[model samples]
Target: METKKGNFSNDNTMESIQKLTEQDAKTFLNLIYAILKDNEIPSEKLISQVLSVYEKKIPRLVKARQDNN
Candidate 1:
């Protein structure tokens, strides 16, 4: 399977809020909100943090899903 990387825009963020079914997305959003609330930082750094977490989680999440099946 070819995995396509998603490009998220400000508009796409709103769409994701409506469309994402996976729990990880919800957890990530919560973490982002917490990070924003806890610190005053540039938006670039905040986005980088969220992307880093998502990258770290993907392999582990795929493995867990395969195990369950």
Candidate 2:
């Protein structure tokens, strides 16, 4: 099987998840839940801020999943 590039693969997502602190991971889960449940768009700035924080703490794999989605 061919390995998928970019954010589409599970490997990337797992890497990101591994980098998050418990609190950060919780926040990320909540954010994703809210978006999916409410069909709302979070503020761009808020998303950017979260991403900035995650970029530093999270693994590239996890970041890739978030980026892909």
Candidate 3:
């Protein structure tokens, strides 16, 4: 699931997203939606960047899930 230059592949992105809680997952998707809505970036190219941020945020949500557990 790893990639060069700290980039994330789609599979890695989905795996990271699956580790989040329901609410956190919803929030994550919402953030992506907001980015697409508010930015001038083209949808095709922006997907990778969105996935990168989504993957990066997974650790925090995972930590919070573990803490709550």
Candidate 4:
């Protein structure tokens, strides 16, 4: 039983959104670390702030991904 709405299906769940595989997590962390290093902003506080922003923007990100798919 699946319902569709604007390119999104009801099959999606919070657990799916929150779950990241170990390799994916490592890659994400590496990318973030590289960006911070390249931009000379390597601070734990900055990382926390960036994560906060990411969390805030997740809804928009999901919509954008759905639109793309």
As for model 4, its CA RMSD to the true structure in angstroms is 8.8
Residue 16's lDDT within candidate 4 is 32
lDDT of 1 by residue, 1-69 (tens): 213554344454444344444686677668767877866768888777766545544434554665777
Identify the runs in model 2 with alpha carbons over 4 angstroms from their true place: 1-8, 39-69
RMSD of 3: 3.1
Q: What is the lDDT for 2 in model 3? A: 53
**Pairing residues by index, what is the TM-score of model 4?**
0.36
lDDT sort, best first: 3, 1, 2, 4
As a TM-score, model 2 comes out at 0.43
lDDT of 3 by residue, 1-69 (tens): 557776567776777677877888788778878777867888777887676666666755676778899
| Off by more than 4 A, model 1 | 1-21, 40-47
Q: List the residue pairs that clash in candidate 1.
A: none
**lDDT of model 4, residue 10:** 26
lDDT of 2: 0.55
Sort by TM-score, best first: what order? Answer: 3, 2, 1, 4
Point out where model 4 deviates above 4 Å.
1-18, 40-69
For residue 69, what is the lDDT in candidate 3? 90
Worst 10 residues of 4 by lDDT: 1-10
